[model samples]
Target: MALTLYQEASCGLIAGAAEAYFSFPFVSACLPRVDPTTLSVVLRAKYRNIFDALYSMSANKKISALWTNAGPYVKTRMGTNVGMLTSYNPSLCYLRDSCGLSETRAQLGASAVSAFFGAACSVPVKNVLAQGKSGSSLDCALKILKSRGPLAFFSGFSRQFALVGPPIMILWFAYENVRKL
Candidate 1:
């Protein structure tokens, strides 16, 4: 039962949505929380104190959670879709043609490579999400680079790679196997 291009695209969309839905809460939880009171006071006399009012709103926590996680969620979802679309066929072809690997082996290799690239690309977005600022991702990346050095962008790469890689590989392997069946 080979999947058509449309079916593959639909699967990618489903996977992206599921990944965003499931991972967002964990991502939100990891974000640094701003102390509402402290933030309010600091912004009280600055620029008409809009920050204070915004941070002090009754729905502050929910709003902050959404704000902090939304960008990363979108980034991650898009990255997932792109990674799957870009890597799947290429990896399969490369592994099969260049390496003379079996279909299963090619799939596993492709999945592993895709997971690695996905995790690598997500480092900056993860950092920005962890900081939970309303600023742009570019600004956050620049701030980390300036304050913590160029390598700061990949600060938690090892840990995140360890956490994310195996599951992705497993999921891809399982999906390919199931599809074969």
Candidate 2:
């Protein structure tokens, strides 16, 4: 539930978890495993449905006004502050023990995986709410909300720039400043 693109990018991608699970002695010794673009169509279809459904709910009227400033849907979830340090423990542990992927690669892989997961999980919802829109994308998410104002938050679009952008940018910029310090 707690995967951050920033943290992943800041570190790296590691496949230790998959490796550990995949490396069961019986399977390792039993047969050969080959990587394939083999996700089930049924699974993929479910994700598409979920995306469309959840995306809309983010904009639903009941979202806590407290989160009215939770940032964009993606931002609110992955925004740097929301992630904090605590959430990285599992991944860090996984990286250290289960997977040997470099911190940077592990993070990057995590981000990529998250994106894929998002596509899979939310695709269904997206299709339902925003399907048929020409090339639905992050930009489209913003565009739709730009004209929407307050209600936009419910759409889970929060336009998040206000709540999340400044703090995140500040941290990134601070890191840059620290390099000189």
Candidate 3:
């Protein structure tokens, strides 16, 4: 009935990849509208809404433009899911068995650890994605590196992680507890 770490990681990776791919269209449409730096791009382009953004992008550019940074998006998603999923069981076991924590406390601890790593893994990519940079993911990456160096990716990590960490912790905590039932 239990899944091994390999199985868990594989499941997480596949799920993350699929989620990113399927959601990229919506994400691509929304990011420019919300990201202040890119909001002007949306406004000047006169995209009224998500549909307008999608329509304009597909009409003016290749349909593939809709998934401009999908590679990095999917990579980040996989890292986050793998961080959460792969760490869950081992961390849970360590907390409960080695650390002598109660079921509830151990579950909470494990979930916290998982969320921390998941957010850590995704923060850099989120920064890159938020920039709404044009080009393939790799090109965007190289541009950032050329302009700002490698550490540029982690630029707003602390603030971003603070915002995202709690929600992800709550998510894993709820999922773990609910799975028990």
> Tens-digit lDDT track for model 3 on 62-153?
88888875786787788778777787788989999999999889988988888777777677677666564576667777778889998888
Model 2 stretches with alpha carbons more than 4 Å out: 1-93, 130-181
* Models sorted by TM-score, best on top: 3, 1, 2
TM-score of each: 0.60, 0.25, 0.66
Which candidate tops lDDT?
3
True-vs-predicted CA distance for residue 63, candidate 1, Å: 13
Between candidates 1 and 2, the lDDT winner: 1
Model 3: lowest-lDDT 10 consecutive positions? 35-44
Candidate 1 C-alpha lDDT tens digits along 1-110 = 65665676577667776767666655544444456667532322232343443444424367544445355576656555655655666677799899999988998899
Question: Model 3: residues >4 Å from true position, as ranges?
Answer: 33-41, 44-65, 123-156
lDDT of 1 at 24: 63
Superposed Cα RMSD, model 1: 9.4
